[model samples]
Target: MPKARAITIHRHFIEPGTDWNTEDFNFSDVLSAQGSSGDALSITPNFRAGAAPENAVGGGNLVDIFNAAAEWWERAILDDFDLTLNFGWAPLGGGTLAVHSLVAQEGTPNRETEGTIRFDNDGSSLWFLDPTPDQNEEYQTFTETTTTQLGGGDINIGRVYTDPVGDAIGRFDLLSLAKHEIGHALGLSRANRSFRAENMDFDIDVQAPRPFPGTEIPTRNGAHLTLNTSLMFPFFVTGERKLQSGIDILANAEISEFNNINLNPVHVPEPTSTPLILSLAMGVGTFVKRKSLKRQSGL
Candidate 1:
């Protein structure tokens, strides 16, 4: 029998066209949220002491975005196990945003047990912490535009539907960052043999059109995808809020399938549907029903 091992992967901040670098990331344990079904995957978040403050931003709290990030993944994967992750704030050297540590059995198909995700809190970068607004309010909301030089051209990276609208200039999107880190914590990494094998299987299964003949795809630091605009890309552009793309979702599904875990790729929500999904998760959608029942005759 093979023993389970822990692997750590670091996410670095890179300027366009620059080579990827390495750094550290952290996590802790505290709150837990269950999915709609018993078989749905659940994530438990633990915050470290005096790490990052629970500052209020927009009309919501800072931790709300992290919770939202967790929920986003939970809705996409349907597994019977709960993943406990520790999160914290730390100085992760230069051009590093976060780090992820995962524990899994060493085999052709690894089964993940738990993981940790730490964000850089070294004060070297500015972060935009804002709650995603409801879908109905998206029309009137706006975000300040910012661009990064990519492919010898300037590309807009700003995102909308964030509270304190128009204030995202020159800052990193915390929600997108959290989602990316969570993706790593969920076993989406090239460093894991299972992930590598599963990714190949995914490409074969989809008959993925390749620009070149290769058994392995191109990646950044052997952990992030470089061929596509994926959330797990090596560089996170400033003012950009990247959501999980179809490829990203399918890649995660492949790894989950390798571990015998069920996945609901079709149920993955778009950005506009996030607020509604989270509301249902927190039972806010059922509030009126619960209140009405309470007002009815006691039984």
Candidate 2:
């Protein structure tokens, strides 16, 4: 059997539908080099109910997003290893042989009480989106999230971008947001540093252990750290296009790997070689056939 070569992305938030534009992520770019160099990888899409929010237990009847995400990975990329993604609820359960877990953190009770930061009206405020429930707002406070295993299970998607009122204010795109967090959950640095060239100085430590101690993953990509290019870039995007260049980069990484396997550039035989080989073999057969026919005819 052929070696497994592919990363499968499972969408846990199917009900709300994903804001992700698969074309934008360029899921084939990352696999380009792999295909060209012979390290082929492909992408499989898994659509399931991976949302396992405690709130979803009621008649809400929402599927266990977290458990579903884990199962998606096990079924999709566990054997493939390129990478599998989940966007919804929290990720529980540990890793399996056939899947690598990728999920986003959803709830944050601690963040709501401590007050969070936000950038609006051309200014940055520390106490603007507080813990009080207002008229237009539903929730408040921002939590410090980390990309760690939940109960020794898979790593939950970390919410580095703090916007308590985003959904209520019609600002946050959950699918887009989850995609960004998923990137970090995979391997993109979890630092607070925004990928933008300007705010590159605001670094958040992503190294160390669970609590996100002191050492942060440097914004600068060195031998140890790699850069992620998804609009889900560590910070936030509030522009008209609302499309970050990083999203393309992240998508490209996946795309590149996928294209490699499907394209099959290396193993494909050249045009000229095919006809030549076939013609030589056919010529011998034709000659033998003519001779046999002549003998049988008694010429």
Candidate 3:
């Protein structure tokens, strides 16, 4: 997870015009891997700014933004656990459907193989569909597969990580987007319309969807605005980085299982040059019970 013994970044899936082949680029440079001072979730984006968007505000250095996003997650949730993320890079050629496309492969004890695991495919690969007002890019759907035991928890076989946020038009925060996707890869899914039950988003099993308690957050201009606290919320505004309590509870429970894993993960080099390999062991990623998506009332 920390180091990609061997990694590469291929072209992304495209529509209408030209789709980048999945074997276009290979990344050896580790842009940022800071779970907390040591080896944590990483971003290997050393390639030129070609992958970055034109309207990019950070001097077009997507690498910095991406790392910060990863770092935020590290601090917010998975920081305690010595986790390593071998990121697969796909420098933005143009505006794409999704910014990040990940495949979370879960493997349990008896059935360590990914295919063997039961997937609650809602028929759609989108874990979290955003409020992308622009409506242009078409990364469309995302899926998951394969499995090999990684320590204790499931290794998120992040097939391909892309960015949905456009450089200039995208007011989305880097950490916000990364955290949202990472949530799914780490067993979190879009809290359906029926997310909140008894004021609990997951309630051990995902329930009806309910907008998390909105906090009065201040804008840069000193104006205050209310933003939903649920990180798993479906609709995405420009800058939303609130970590809900329930998600924390779930992720914490998941992390406890990893306590059995060695502080440092053993790097298993892959045959393919470009691929993020993550496998969840039995107690965790198995028996994925998709919470019924019964619409509830909320914003």
For model 2, how does the per-residue alpha-carbon lDDT over 89-206 read when each residue is reduced to its tens digit?
2232221101113232212110000101001111111112212211212222111112222122222122122223332232322223332333333333322112222124543333
TM-score of each: 0.56, 0.26, 0.35
Per-candidate Cα lDDT values, in order, are 0.45, 0.24, 0.27
Q: Cα RMSD to native, each candidate?
A: 14.3, 23.7, 19.5
TM-score of predicted structure 3: 0.35
lDDT of 3 by residue, 1-299 (tens): 45422111111112222333433322111111111044333323222212333333424233343454444444333322322232322433222212322222323311000000011112221122233311212221122321222222332222211233333233443434444444433333222111111124223221112111221111110111111233444444442223232333233223222222111121222322333434443344422211111222221
Identify the superior model by TM-score, candidate 2 or candidate 3: 3
Model 1 misplaced stretches (Cα beyond 4 Å):
1-39, 53-62, 104-109, 132-164, 196-218, 258-299
Instruction: Please give the range of 10 consecutive residues that has the lowest summed lDDT in model 2.
Output: 110-119
Error of 2 at 295 (Å): 82
Model 1 per-residue lDDT tens digits across residues 163-184: 3224455556677778777777
- lDDT score, candidate 1, position 109: 40
Better model by lDDT, 1 or 3?
A: 1
